[model samples]
Target: MAGLDFLNGELEELKRQGKYRLPSVWESGSGAWMDIGGRRVLQMASNNYLGLTDHPRLKRAAVEATEKYGVGAGSVRTISGTLDIHEQLELELARFKDTEAALVFQSGFTTNQGVFGTLLQEGDVVISDELNHASIIDGIRLTKAARRIYKHKDMDSLEQALRESSGYRTRFVVTDGVFSMDGDIAPLPQIVELAERYDAVVCVDDAHASGVLGRFGKGSTDHFGLHGRVHIQIGTLSKAVGVVGGYAAGSQALKEYLIHKARPFLFSTSQTPAVAAACLEAIRVLQDSPELGERLHASASSFRTRLQADGFDTGVSETPIMPIVIGDSARTMRFSARLLELGVFAPGIVYPTVGEGKGRVRFIVTAMHSDEDLAFARDALLQAGREFGLV
Candidate 1:
């Protein structure tokens, strides 16, 4: 009871910092337009970049797989639950990524944990970008590896860290392919150069980049034309793939190592058969069509360009994710609430998600949105932003 009491104190501090958040329950299908609880809203807060969550092909694949393999994988993958659909998904992902091999995990967060938790050792070193995901930070902690955080996307800082870590038994340089909050891509070509100069293993978490960047959505490696240079490539099925799971694409040896030693993968039950089938179908769709990603980026550029002309602070965003910086968390949250009431569901990213005094309402543009949707969103945004004094 005494230990549990600490939660109240922590939550109170979070509230004081304006970092406390409670998301609206999204009950209906997630797409360009979604039903939040019972109200319909134009979606902008999701990571579903391609708007494939409710696609017909994915739906049909899920239904068919369910009819064939039932609802669940009966046990953990290492036990007796590695279904044919699971293997098929892995193979397809490998092909999609143009990697030597691929291994699926239950979620992107877990995929990070699995990779760092298994491949790294106590004396190994982790050189990470300061703005890497929480999953990467937690994964490093799980490995008990020494970590050095470089300034976000600063190659000079990364090279310094790598130089300092030269004497370590093994070194890993990790970064998110895209910074989720800023929507700017990591300087991966520079990172690859630094890693090679220091002989460090490079790992890129492509959660936000997968199915949203590169030719046919092959993610950051393909986006930068650094296909075989990087060592570990991680991705998600939940975001652009519009399904639910994660994966790591690397050498066949890396897959074998993870299969044997990754505790999360070995201990947790595998993803459902239908999820595997749905994810595979999602990959196929992405491979067959490049127009969706192109259109999504174009929409994002138009919105950002328009917002900037209206005197809104749209920070360094180069992708479909656009953030309207407001500097005050309470005001950002207020802007978000008013916008939601006005029929858009773009959410606030406050301290901890961003930093103190740099709060914003982050928008994720998708391909499925029509011209009417964009026009409506522009008007809603202008009115709400003006009301909140953010514009």
Candidate 2:
């Protein structure tokens, strides 16, 4: 058959299996409210946890940097692409993470890909949380190392994998700082203890945790007081920092080695000067203002309490990333549609993003949302649930 025909056939199969996903288009900047195809809606699907995406400080910094450095880095870091701004951003990230060193990548996904593929070799083993983000899984797949998956947040299962991998030349336990799907925190302290006992390196993907958890938002390691125990700390600037790109924090030697060996870092152009400068400003904003974090947590608490009180089945979510479980994919989709009609913009999350029979409408709260905004969302969601016969 023709190539287009084959592609269409695969897409049809995916649709028939209830696994095809089409994203909605948004025309405005990310905030508590957004414009979706000309309709204004209360956005509860963004990872802009701290709501800094359109902050004046970040915009000014980005604009100034663009004027000074132009649009792109023009080359990869290993070649002549390591701009002074890139170095500054790396140093700032290292200081913020309290790590010996840091390395910037084109994105959070590539950071995982580069770090994991560079560190693990044929005889090595990677024990990862089953629900880890796709980037980590893909990164492991790119490596020659053996991969073992443990039940999500199950320390005993992780220990078993670690114990079974004793013969491997190297063992690394990888997990998300805060599981994106369920919004539950990883048992990092237990994982750290196990890593020590098993002589394994512990790495955490803090994509969702960096700008929302810990004191001054230092991420899961600081949240659990693990500090120097975590061998690798990966995070993104696109989420709460409300910019673009990603970084990995670790010992100076590890970063130096990745600089020379990691293909993505060596081959990809560095992040634009505007993005790097904006990220730096965002970090400064987070550090100087504790009110943003407090407001975000308060909004999350309020929403969670109201949802639970109204009898919505919110799973074990302790963070701003909450999910209203609806089991059936079609029903979850319908629920999200109803929510959209009610002027809320949370999207349905179905299989592949989650496991089978675990479809839900994910709600993300932001610090920029006022009490009225949250109250409006709660009312809208309750109405949608009742209309859909969910509650």
- What's the TM-score of every candidate structure? 0.97, 0.97
Alpha carbon lDDT of each predicted model: 0.90, 0.91
Candidate 1 displacement at residue 175 in angstroms: 0.6
lDDT, candidate 1, 4-37, per-residue tens = 9989999998788667787678878777788876
Clashing pairs in 1: none
lDDT by residue (85-159, candidate 2, tens digit) is 888888999999999999989899999999999999999999999999999999999999999999988988998
Which candidate number maximizes TM-score? Answer: 2
What lDDT would candidate 1 get against the real structure? 0.90
